[model samples]
Target: MKQICAFLVIILLTSCEYFNVKKTSSEAILNEELETFNWNDVDEYPSFSSCDSVSSKQEKKQCFTDILTGHIFEYLQDEIIIVTQDINDTIDLKLQISNTGEITLLESDVDSLTVKEIPNINDLLVRSLDTLPKIFPAIKRGQQVTTEFKLPIIIGVD
Candidate 1:
């Protein structure tokens, strides 16, 4: 009887330990999630209403780009630009789309020659953006997020 009782006590202790669950602190869980989270990528790119219907991610991005470029081109075409010298250059336009869907021009990288030929190039670009349709901000982890874009605008005039 004594030996049986000792064996039962040992079994009870072992069974209790087996049922024990390790408690994880909230900080540790949060840290682990942060480590696995990607900061640079967005789940969905910013889009205009016209681009919202697209299903594929790549196609949505392409649609947004096409619409933006088309609007800028149309706006520029409407204006009569006169340059004495033949101008052919590309402007790297840096833009920021806020989480609230507002567009802002961060900067414009214009060559010295291009700047000289088109003094108001920056103004024109800004004005062109002002004419853009209502934009839907980018999405990351199901939350609206601000995003930056570098768009190349080609300027060719004979």
Candidate 2:
């Protein structure tokens, strides 16, 4: 009877040790997984309303960029602003697309001469941005996230 009792105690102790090791390993794995997650890298790029039907990732990205460019050009093409001279320049626009697909114009960099030539150019750009449909924000590990974009617009006098 004493031998049997000793055997049972040894079995119980070994089982307990195994359980403890298992629990520690599981926790370590969870921590490692959390640490490996990257907050800066996005799983998917932001999407435009026009890109929703696309199936592939590259196609979606291209569609979004193309549609946005078209919209910006379309709005700018309609503006009647005149420069002091026939000027051609490029405007660098900084834009942020929020996690909820909201668009914000962060900044616009235009040549001093361009600004002087066409005062309402900034307003025109802002209006064009406002007219754009809501964008689908970028995806990071299945969560929607805000993203920044830099768009360059070409102004041609012809």
Candidate 3:
């Protein structure tokens, strides 16, 4: 019975979870957990000049992603215009953007996801772009801002 109880205690301490380190049955670690963590979940953490200042790399990355996503709508608008333009005046095109920043710009024939119109359209689709999203400035705590980003662009090539 004692052995089973000990095994149960060990199992309770550690569980397989993605992106997280499992804690062991250690007393010191429990004390750390008990201590209140001083974190401002709302105050987005921006880019830190030194890797040392950042609490965790994941926090930094999330800040970057939030900053990037905020401008995702903007970049999508630019991308549609650039790719639809007649580079050599050989293509016909009409492009438009939505308030949410979805895209619809195609040439003669489309072999993938696209829209016939922009207004009143409903659907959220992810596309890859030839150019990556440019990181925009983001507000962080204490008036500090950070810049980092990710954008996927989908180009249909015949």
Candidate 4:
């Protein structure tokens, strides 16, 4: 009888441990699933109004970039910028679009030569962006979300 009782106790202890392990693992799995659903799931990417006609995701993205590039280039193309250095320069801009369709200048990547040449370049860029029409914000599970974009501006002398 003592031996049988010992065996039952061992079984109970092992079963309890098994349940505990499973509970912890299940909790971890639940957290992981939530993170994936939140971060990795994007229903649709942000796009400019001009891209609305495009159906495919890739095409929409391309159209959005093309339209924005053309617009900014048009804005700065006429301006004559003089720099001390003869090296070719490019400006990298990071823009953020809010859920409410507002655009903000997050950061600008420019070299010393570009800044010295055109100190008000950032302001000009912002003004140019202000003229742009509102963009449709990104969507995730039917809700609009803010998005960021990096744009390259290459400067060439005429």
Q: Please, what is the whole-model Cα lDDT of each candidate in the order they appear?
A: 0.92, 0.85, 0.39, 0.81
Q: Model 4: how large is the Cα RMSD against the reference?
A: 3.9
Give the C-alpha miss distance for residue 77 in model 1, angstroms: 1.1
Candidate 2, residues 1-158, lDDT tens digits: the string is 99999999999988886666434688899899989987656778898766878888888878888888889999988878666687688999899999988888899999888888888888888899899977889998778999887888888766
TM-score of each: 0.84, 0.74, 0.22, 0.75
Q: Is candidate 1 or candidate 4 better by TM-score?
A: 1
Error of 3 at 141 (Å): 16
- Judged by whole-model lDDT over C-alpha atoms, candidate 3 comes out at 0.39
Error of 2 at 138 (Å): 1.3
Q: What would the per-residue lDDT of candidate 3 be over residues 20-48, giving only the tens digit for each residue? A: 86667777776786575443332443332
Name the candidate, 1 or 2, with the larger TM-score value. Answer: 1
Ranking by lDDT: 1, 2, 4, 3
1 or 3, which is superior by lDDT? 1
After the best TM-score superposition of candidate 1, give how far the Cα of residue 140 lies from its true spot, in angstroms. Answer: 1.0
lDDT of 4 by residue, 72-135 (tens): 8888875676666664678898988798878888999988877777888898888888888778
Clashing residue pairs in candidate 4 are: none
Flag regions of model 3 displaced more than 4 Å.
Answer: 1-25, 28-35, 38-71, 79-125, 128-158
lDDT of 1 by residue, 1-158 (tens): 99999999999988998888999999999999999999888999999999878999999989988899889989989988889899889889899999999999999999998888889989999999999999999999999999999998888877
